[model samples]
Target: MSEVRVILHTDKRQALLREAQAEIRENQGRIPAGDFYARKLSAAWRRARGTRAYGPGEDQDDIGEFSLERFRDLPVTPRESLKAQPLRYAAVTPTEASEYYETTGTTGQPTPTPRLAEDTIWNTVSVAEAWRPLLGADERVVILLPSDVVPVADLVSGVCEYLDLAHIRAYPFATGITGWDRLEAMWRTFRPTTVFVAPGVALQFTRLLAQRGQLDELSSSVDRLACSGGGYTYTAAAGPGPSAARVGLARRTQGRPALPGGEASPGGRHCLHRPHRRTRAGRPG
Candidate 1:
């Protein structure tokens, strides 16, 4: 069962969504790739000096105009920097940051990654644009991902709010609150039309349904199942692909729809799975 449930009142969420939409509108729906990275890297460079190799230096003032050559010249921060000294990477102060989160440390040590209102709005709207076609106001979404210190749940919540779609968080791994049994009970009443889950968890849930002989009855209402996680290992030659699992869950569950992937620290996260047409051959994309 789920432990946390923080609902942003409808009015507040709408206001925030509008701000995100305006940002996209002003940029003409797409920001130049080079200019986006140039601004981000430049801001990161202006942070407080430290013993880190990429700290401020004499050449800090004159970062030339945005160009392919100039962008390449900018210092590239190593992935290990987050694990070594997380605070040094923060471009905003504690007061400025609206929310605080940390990674699962699956790949390495968990790192602190705080976010601002701007971060939430931008990420929400960007993903909503790509997912809007697949979602509708009449549909109800069930998000089966971890919410504590993880940005994926929050990102999905933001997208739902932005699109004015109904949604609920029912992470089955949340022991007492959203355990498999409890979630099964909730499904009877909620009757979600869409489900967003991780690949591993989705498989586990499917097995649970089949064991209980309720796979068809419980999954009948669900038409869409979107999975996102660290990495997908399913292969058509050996391991089970998404199509095989989808078939077990429900007859109506549609083809794979792309959703943005989240990191332990989900700052500036973007789409991971690309939308693909459903194939008769059932190949994993």
Candidate 2:
């Protein structure tokens, strides 16, 4: 199948982001504590085959009590089925979708996932809101993540544009394009204050700077580092010595609890990173 071009309605998404941020602020970051998922589940019950196995119950007519037992009763969709017949799990048809993305197929066949504009807007707004406290107008962002055939890069890029921050897409892994040398050159010229990078790439780039004895010169300018994708090690963003403290880099799992050096944010497992500090970027746990 031919690739579907991604149309990012940046202006509209940005306006939505702003609206979402305003709503979040007004609500004090609190969401309806009651039956949120149940409401959605009730609405999707008729169309969602994943829930078709459920026996009829009187409570199914409305937003029923969502208990662990009730949830446990729902049938799990196997990966094979998802790969072979993705439409079985979809709420919208691929034709109705505005954007398309695919899994890496590392586990099996690549699964095609189509998304609506609402998906992009909601995801970007939620993530951007979580990270908003850490970013500012003066922040120049360098994204060292893949932009081809995946949604991760787009998500971060959307958040950057939504927040009106200056950012560039330069993946070091894209050899002959934004290779290590090119990335280093760009780093020097761009002097990015913030970076959203993959953990492995962050380590590789840090090591490159160390080998050239430019760690201090180059790293000094970077105040914040946010990493996603792959297994992360503390040293990936910390570099060596007191640089962790100097740069304010701390590693935490997303959405757990705020680490000692980091500030806490609500929502998602990837919220444990200390956004208030310039140095630590982990999946905020």
Candidate 3:
């Protein structure tokens, strides 16, 4: 098994590192060992370290002698820096590349992130490992998200493929209310044990389905509901209320609780606010 550990100032980083380490140890000897993402990050860290030197002779000294204090003094690389040197920034060559992903660029320009082939494989493996406990061997899964292939959807699809589960489906809903009827049709036909959705579309679908008394149609087959694409607020901007409320509705209808640590917006009605009990009560079982 390959093991990769990341250390950051935050506890969240530490916890993630531990989880990754545990995953590595769990699969040790079965795969190449080491953090692929960390390797890329470490390369960036080295570049940051090298740029911090002040004295004339500092350039000639071995990296081992490079002071940690100087490294700490290095200016952080901005998104533009990564964008400026995408090729140099990569830890591994394309030969080891399995997939390419991009930031949605909602804030600014999108940045393309490349994944090493092994990292992609391990990612699917990790997901399968986590999901195996929750999902049964015979359970069916349907992925309903954007048409454009995103990393999260790709990961979910790849994991389903790896598991060789009996039924796995993908229906592209894109953004907004563009494909509600099509999505509804697929929902009826697939009757999946799992359903994944983009945040905005998930919310819209939840509202529409609830209004039409069709929410239970989805809940009947889908026990697990997964969503991604920013927080509920960002998602809500694309349509109605926060994505979390939509997620909560999906979970409640399906008889499950929402996943923790999802993004939130204070005083945001559509993204983070819980649905009104009256609204939920009026919905059909």
The number of the candidate with the highest lDDT is: 1
**lDDT (Cα, tens digit) per residue for candidate 1, span 2-76:** 111132335776677677577555654365565765665554444423323345454544443445575577676
State residue 238's C-alpha deviation in candidate 3, in Å.
21
- Give the least accurate 10-residue stretch of model 3, judged by summed lDDT: 262-271
* Residue ranges of candidate 1 with Cα displaced over 4 Å: 1-19, 23-68, 105-107, 231-285
All candidates: TM-score: 0.68, 0.68, 0.57
Error of 2 at 212 (Å): 2.1
Summarize candidate 3's per-residue lDDT along 25-139 as a digit string, tens digits. Answer: 5764465446654554554455434332322244443333344465566566575777776554554444655456665522355556666544554465565555555567876
**Model 2 residue 232 distance off true place after TM-score fit, in angstroms:** 6.0
Against the correct fold, how does model 3 do in TM-score? 0.57
Please estimate how well model 2 matches the true structure, expressed as its whole-model Cα lDDT.
0.57
Model 2 misplaced regions, further than 4 Å? 1-23, 26-28, 40-72, 104-109, 230-285
lDDT for model 3, on a 0 to 1 scale?
0.49
Give candidate 3 regions above 4 Å deviation: 1-75, 92-96, 105-107, 167-171, 174-178, 230-285
